[model samples]
Target: MNFRIPIFSLLMIGFSQSAFAQIKEEQLILDRKREPEIKKIEKKKTSVEAEKNYPPREKKIEDSLNLRYTVTDVPAASDFKTSTIQGEDISPKFEAENLNNYFQLGMGNFGRILADGNIGTKLENEIEVGADFHVLSTSGLKKEYPWSSKQNIGNVAAYLNANGEKGKFNVIADYGLNDYNLYGIYALQPDADTDLKQRTNRFKVNGYYDFYSNEILNNVRLKTSFLGDHFNAKESQAEIRVNLSKHGVELPVGNDVVLNADLGLNLETLNTDFAILQENSSKFLNATVAPQVTFFNGDSYLMLGSDFSFLNAKNSTANTDQVQENRTYWFPKAELQFAAADEFKFYAGVTGGLQLNSFANLLETNPYLLSDQQLRPTETKYKGYVGLRGDIDQQIKYDFRAGFGKINDMVFFRANDLFDTSVSGNRAAYDYANSFSAVYDNGKVSEVKASVQYFPLANLTLDAEAQFTKYDLENYEHIYNVPLLKAGIGAKYSMLNKKLHLGANAIFSTDLTTNSFEITESGSQPNVFISTENNDDKVGGYADLNLSAEYRVHKNFSIFALGNNLLNSNYQTFKGYKVLGAQILGGVKISF
Candidate 1:
């Protein structure tokens, strides 16, 4: 599950600008004339440089001591079920059972693990190596009872840095795996006979270098990365991205001052056995580039950028099934910060883009498995957005955004009725002998969001956010009228000399518009049309409540107890997805 943690700096900039606007008009005019003088005064009134640079500092070595283990049973509605079509006396049934039982073992400081501190050890020639890893797991399935599943996730990363006297360079790599297994649940079949499994892996490696050493071009940086993944198919995809960027350039470009540019090129390829089955499995290759230019004033900035992507994909799956897609995108991104007062700032930006996907990859892995399919691998889209954000005070800030977009030839999975088995002329009906289809359609989507953060005390903070999204399909066969909204609030407190930490987060989500699923025929044959008008009417949200206490017994030995899902709240963030309720576990650690 992905959680959106409201960004803090984006709000501070807006708030700082707003506060500066409160200055009197006369002061503004005089301030402009006295800008240089004010700058000189500021420089002269500064604290001692040596003292400022050598301020008090904290040591890094720490350890975790002690441990705790806690588990609980949760109650909720199940999202997955097995049913038979052909008018068989098959109906979806929900079995009541405990969902989620997991233990969290905290080693050393929770914050240290959460922050993922980089361990850099000096090697020969100013070279260094850094590594980091995090793992979290939960067991025992609850809610959508009967069909139980086990969930696990972990991330590992390592990097090597070479900082030479002339310049700096680095190479880094990361690997992540997420998997889920459902046991004793019969899917796509009748009877609790067989179980299903799903797994996904993502990995990437990147290389970067700073070309200039001691010049204005020192702000210029160039880097490239190779990213690969195997999510839908067993095959892996490899892509390369090369970027050229320059920042903090104080120069004039025509009438606009302070200009910068960022440009990048991306090349990608996919190697898989599915390509052999679909015949469309040719050496997949493509290239894309995005270039951006920005003009900045003392308090405002404007940006223009565009992305051009091209792809060459082949599917030899007879006629019509041979797939290929090429795409291009044009976008304009801009932002302007207006300081309306000395202590307040109001800022907003409008951004949108147009994209054309001439080639679409719809078939999962191998297309040859099916004898007939009718999906055109091409699409076009348009999108745009507007948002405002800023700080109300030093301790409070907020942001909101709204956007609209439309996608033409939007690919969708299409299915047919199993009984209508007239195979001729129908590619999907003849080949799969099933009633499912994936096609493209034209659709529009809109989204809105607002979030705020407030620090009530020096060591305590509160945050709340809301998001609403809507999707309108112009020509869809399987479903229609899909709209969803989400809202959430969370709080964090720092205690025990900032060593012990406690936080709680709650997220609420619901569908405003109803979606219809085609019901399957019962008994002999499966009904292809499963429709739902009122939806599941979900009303509850997931809560992430955790408390961790760490005590520094000595300079290098620290003990702590960490609790995750403290309340053991039982809820699912997505339909059919089960999350562990609560777990409390702790462990000791020795640190350098």
Candidate 2:
């Protein structure tokens, strides 16, 4: 069905290009009016001082003016979902489906504007609305179901920010909203069951105030903001900041030192009364107070910072159930830099936090006779990382980062322990890599390039990384190792007097980790089956290949085309999650 729609869309575009041209023209006008700041910035600046005097501002103005609209109606092929074991689940065969393979019929428009150097001057305003609708189907299912739930989701977002200088103070306010047709903090799985149908609404506001002073002994900045969302439920958070920094200051323990200090307070509340027919609704309220101090030397100097946060949470259910959870976290981050060469620089940093989550009568019995307290760990996760960076005249640059950490009271879900949660050994992950690029910036032509780095380690896991996720299910924790070496290389080149450009990228990884299941425990009843999946740290590796091209038809118009999975590779980024197979997409744009 997806493939058929794309074919139909092509025929329609050829038939009605002229009719829609006028609509595009009106949209361009509205685009400029909506983005005043963008027009101001692009008005041509003559001096560096003028640009520097411009107060710090969001980049939305610049980004909004260069918007692109895409309309594709094609059912591209999808990659098959790999099983826990390397063996294909032939009994319940899951066929490959296209990524963005479903048909799309929607209208989207975006715009932005900017302002020049001015204090107390409004900087930017932006608005955007985009939508997509598609029909997805599943042919094979392991379990019997009356029907496959329809998949439909739409999102809309807009932002506004204002900046100005009031007397000796710098002030700014920002507001925005993002609505998604999904729930939870975790990334949405394409096949995951979701009762959430409509888009979720979220609203946020942030503001900062800086009291400016040339006095070398005393300067201060104060900030406070609030964020909240209301749709299926209500969740709100607020924060405050007070900071002071001095230059060329002498302290009791040091000379020629820059001293800085900060104090903050935050409160977050989440209240939800899950509908019995839908899911369990729970309400929670949390508050915290944080304070910290940071110091940075003049240029090329050492940096140190530390802060502490305390939190309390009270949860209530529609059934008049209540629980309390408390936690305190200490976070400290530090960095150092060393010049290794006139053309090379090296820097390293380490950051992590000490966090403890405890339940004081935090759990109670539910109607299902399950102990909620057992589902959570008393001593949770405290993760950290250390990384280094090197730059060699931009032509050769690399970033290497390694992490050491785990959750003490990690949660993992199991079918057997549906109601009971067990504490798993800390699951740890460590990944480090470095990339090199052959880059050049010269008059008339310029191109930025980079190549992937190959590095490997143990004790790592891969999951949905596109967005945050949250759930009330048993904590399903697994220890997976990615000792595979991987590399990706890509570059862009411009021709036709820099009017047209082309780019391509390819990534590959070898040394596979295949899964193997074993009987961890048998059911209490004789002849009852019980088993778990084990993995082989060795097997066939996976690879991904992509290529794309762009052509500048004119100053106000351009075209782009691309193909992914050019080799039609079949693989998965993580177990159970399906990847997209070979696909192609192309579009055109017109801008003022």
Candidate 3:
């Protein structure tokens, strides 16, 4: 989804596993039920529209995702999860009452190979078991880029779910592997060896149970994960969440009220062999208890809550060189919903919390990040917002929201030092300033977002969304690599009695910024600092236009094709990285 220096001395620079060792890490993936990136794929699920909307599995129904789409997301996030230009929503909710199986195989230019499928079966004791998998690999952009390398990325998982009058439970495990080159404009060496590679993988387990009989333990979620690379850099993390609620209790007030509480525990430990300066190793943990009460009369409702948490972290370069850092925090939470009209509503809320920043998580966004550079957790001091949404008759729906917040330890990235210690030293395949390192800064942010959906005709769907953010930092001229303005617009049309589907998507983001570094040594000593005025570089923004088509050959089969970067973009997603361009994939889908 993301270089090789040919001059690399493979034998002399083979990554060292002899450094201080950190244990392994595991991961857990929880998919929310949302529309797939490809809307046509949803209709392809079944000939009957009713089955298209999966029968409810959990007793609780999540809010429908059809109203509005969440646009691009913050780059500083631990999970780096945000909607892309495609605006597709993907979450694994495998507990549907009726499960169908399908298999897809595709091939395209640039050696692109895509395969995805899911299999499930009903078991005794009201239990269900299934497996889902998707994998894609592409030849590097060497055809046009001359310097890019091929990439292979994908994931697969197995799950077991059961439900009854008492409750429901599910257990899942998954693993993912990504292999790519770190060919940066600056990292390239005359003798660079593109054949040498960097590989990363993660393994995880997730378990969840919802209870109907026990009020104290109504919902429990548990997960543990491990992430590491070929060099032995690793992160181990575990999490637990529980929700308890009391409903329909008679109170002194007129309307019946519900009391609820949530408990959470998250912990992680990481070790990334060595940075340019020091070995990186650290641990982070957060425990929190939140309680709230809600009262509703008619269509109007109100709720209030408070979150209290204790945060702890231990960071250092050596086993004995660590000091445990601890702090306690309290945040306010509240929301109000009013019936502005029978079909329209107005709502507002106040929310804030601590965001865990870990290498295991950050890698999702910037896979080119160095193996080790310990970073502090980013804290959201506070954020307040309001919004209103409704429909124009039966064909159109809209949503809007705006908010302002202050952040502590806001994180951003910059190029690594091209040369070791001010212009000299052996470098890893990724260290040529082509790779990014995390930097911490504090700042205030303001943002506004809006999205709309129109179904003018039964077979035609129109969607568009946009978001803009302003960052005012205390220590940087600009927030490098994070998008300041982003937007997406798409259209999907069905013809030939719904058997033929056509779609187009246009995803855009403003130009991104990057800061370079130069080292000058005074005699034998060296110093490190950014010279923003002279080193700042701009990476041009892009309009990634894509088109897709699919034809249902029969109730159990279909054929499809996808065209990416139809504009043959030369823009870079990162400072020096170029995206694969003008490629098409054709495939067949079979259902059983």
Q: lDDT winner among the candidates?
A: 3
Candidate 1: stretches off by over 4 Å:
1-120, 142-148, 182-193, 210-232, 245-256, 270-284, 315-321, 325-329, 333-381, 408-441, 477-483, 512-570, 573-575
**Among all candidates shown, the one with the greatest TM-score:** 3
TM-score (C-alpha, index-matched) for candidate 2: 0.49
| Cα lDDT of model 1 by residue, 1-592, tens digit | 3554444323422332343332111010000111111121122212112222221120000000001000001101111111100001101111111111111234221121221122435566656565644453444454434443544555566766555544456555766555544331212222222233444455655555544322323222222222222223334555555556565455745543665566767776654433212333333566667787766554445666766656565544433454565555454455555545423444455444332221123322212112223333333344666655555665766666677876666554333333333322332211222222445677777878776677667766667667777767766432322236666555554454654333444445453222223333454544333322333334244434433333344434444444444455544332233344444334433344
lDDT (CA) per prediction: 0.40, 0.30, 0.60
RMSD of 2: 16.6
Window of ten residues with lowest summed lDDT in model 1: 61-70
Assess candidate 1 and give its lDDT.
Answer: 0.40
Tens-digit lDDT string for candidate 3 (108-165): 7778777777777768766777776777677776654455467777777777766666
Each model's RMSD to truth, in Å?
A: 16.0, 16.6, 11.9
Off by over 4 Å in 3: 1-99, 145-148, 187-189, 250-252, 255-277, 318-320, 419-426, 517-535
